[model samples]
Target: MAFFTGKVALVTGGSSGIGRATAVAFARQGAKVVVASRRVAEGEETIGLVKAAGSEGFFIKTDVTNEADIKTMVEKTITAYDRLDYACNSAGMEQQPTPITEQTEETFDQIVNINFKGIWLSMKHQISQMLQNGGGAIVNISSAAAIRPIPGIHLYNASKEAVLGLTKSVALDYAKSGIRVNAICPGGVKTEMFERFTKDNPQAADAIIQMHPMGRVGESEEIADGVVWLCSDQASFVTGQILAIDGGFILQ
Candidate 1:
């Protein structure tokens, strides 16, 4: 039987990029998938990919910043699958580079609310369900910025670092209860966000590529593969850890 043959996974921000990739990966392993995102059309497209992988899939229009939407997202998942087996909190946002001196409170709130607060809220509901189900796994998509300082994006840096703190604490709290909570710190990835960030600076783009020891940007599927492994029984002993899949970005 497939490793995840009877499992169910919830992936927030599943409309595109890493979230979409992780949802598809779970489905490929025979798990029914719940894809939660604000973009209905793109989320439904992800479900199509999941169905193409031959596993059942559902979509929930969710805004993680809204507590009610998050609760509904979890409820709808259980309503469809009866249990929650795994979750990937991949909903995140990155603003254009701005100095801290010029940063606005509105921008700070936007970044923190979605990137940090969203994951916390997600875990609150996901853990409650996992406790009832006896056990499960969760992967939060943190960033390399959380590990090392990055200039021009102070808000994004702070928000991602905060996610790590919360991930470790929650993992420790629930480790004894059979829930594994972990975070993935990915380096520069070739996503729409990355593309948007580097569009105006060819030299900056080249600098990013060279920063990774791998000599290239990471792919969404690469991160998805790690997420799948972490959520699988193979990683049962792993919790309260931050896995850096950053291709040596922090090493340099």
Candidate 2:
């Protein structure tokens, strides 16, 4: 039987990058998936990819930072699938790089709102839904920045660190209730966000690859694979851990 046959999954930020790859992965494994993102067109593209992979899929317009949008996303998922078997809170934003001393309050707040509070709101509603069904798995897309700070982007690093803490708390609080939560810290993946960062600071881009002992940037599908494993029964005993898929960046 397919590992995720008859399951239902919701992936926030499913319009692109790691989120898009992960959403497609779940659907290919036989799970009905809900792809939510603020970009309606891109979100629909992801849904189409999921359908092409041979599973049911739909798109929901969502802004992870907004509580109302998150509530609607969860409600729609339940309304369509009856229960949520898995949820991957991967929606986030990366602002222009700024030194800690020069960072404005507006920039800091924007980063925190999307990266940290977004996950919090998603967990609140997703956990509630999973409880009704008796169990589920959740994987939060954090970054290696959570473990090792990037010099120019302090706010982004701090926000990811918060994600790690949140993942642990949710895992512990609901482990006995049959829910599992974990975080994946991907480093230097070749995504639109990474490309934008590189475009803004080419030197930083080169340095980033050199830092990865593997000598190449990681791919979105690679991170997606880690997420899929974490959500599958293969990782049944794992919870509250941050798995790094960073091409050996941290080791160096």
Candidate 3:
């Protein structure tokens, strides 16, 4: 049987990048998938990809930072699949890449609410459902910046650091309960967000690439593969850990 056969997974920010790839990966492994994001059109597209992967899929318009929206997203998932097996909390926004002094309270709050609080709220509901269903796995998408410095985007770094803390604490709290929580810290990945962030400065992009010892940026699918393994039985012994999927970027 397929590794994830008879399983159900929810991917937040499933509209694009790592989230989209993870949703497809789960579906390809025979898992029913629920794609959640604020972008309705993109979420629908991701569900199409999930269907093309030969598994059933559903999309819920979700704003991760909104408590009501998050609760509804989980409720709808239960209504459709009857149970939740795994989840990838990949919904987040990129930092504006400005110095700490230039950053305003507005930007700081935005970063915190989505990158940190969003995951907390997600875990709160997801864990509740998983407990009811027996147990499950959760993977939060953090960043390499959480471990190493990436200059400029201090707020982003702080937010992601909080993600790791939350992941570890929750994992420990539920270690005996069957719900496994972990975080993935990916290094410079080449995604639409990356392109947009660097479109105005080719030199900055080149510098970013050179920072990785692998001589290249990582891919969304590459990270997605790690997420799938972490959510699968193969990683049954793993939890409360931060898996850095960076291409040796932190070594430097």
Candidate 4:
């Protein structure tokens, strides 16, 4: 049988990058997928890709930072699938690289609201729905910056570190309830986000690639594969852990 033959999954930020890839992964594995994002067009594109992979998929316009939107997302999932089997909290934003001393309050708040609070809000609604269904799996997309500081992107680094903490805390609090929570710390992946980061900072991009002992940037699909495994029965015993999908970057 397919690993996720009858599962249902919700992927936040599913319009692009890691979230988009993960959404496609779930659909390919036979899960009914709900791809949520702020961009309707991108969300529709993600749904098309999921359908091409031979799974049922739909798009939901969502802003993860909004409580009402998150609540609506959870409601829609339950109404459509009757249960929430898995959720990937991949919605986030990275601030423009700026020295700490020069960072503006507006940028800092925007980063925190979307990257940190967004995940928290997603978890809040998703967990509640999962509880009604007996159990579920959740994966939050963190970053290598969570463990190691990135000099210019201090705010981004801090937000991801908080994601790590949130993952562990949720895992412990809900283990007995049959809900598994984990986080993935991905290295530089060749996504639109990475491309944007590198557009003006070629040197930064090159240095990042060099740090990865694997000698290349990671692919979004590669990180998505990890998300699939974590949500599958194959990872039944895994919880409260930070899985780094970096190309050996953490080693050195």
Better of 2 and 3 by TM-score: 3
Model 4: colliding residue pairs? none
Clashing pairs in 1: none
Instruction: For candidate 4, write residues 1-252 as lDDT tens digits.
Output: 668988999999999999999999998899999999999999999999999999997899999889999999999988888999999999988766788899999888899989999999999999999999999999999999888777789999999999999999999999999999999999889998888888888898898899899999999999999999999989999999999999987788
Candidate 2 minimal-lDDT segment of 10 residues: 93-102
Against the reference, the lDDT scores of all candidates come to 0.93, 0.93, 0.93, 0.93
- Badly placed stretches (over 4 Å) of model 4 are none
Write model 2 residue lDDT over 31-119, tens digit each, in one string.
Answer: 99999999999999999999998999899999999999999999999999899999999999886667678889999888999999999
Across residues 1-252, which tens digit of lDDT does each residue of candidate 1 receive? 576998999999999999999999999999999999999999999999999999988999999999999999999999988999999999999877787789999998899999999999999999999999999999999999899867888899889999999999999899899999999999998887888888889998998899899899899999999999999888889998899989899998
Q: Worst lDDT window (10 residues) for model 4?
A: 91-100
Model 2 segments more than 4 A misplaced: none
Tell me the tens digit of each residue's lDDT in model 3 across 59-94.
999989999999999999999889999999999888
TM-score of each: 0.98, 0.98, 0.98, 0.98
> Residue 128 of candidate 4: its Cα lDDT?
97
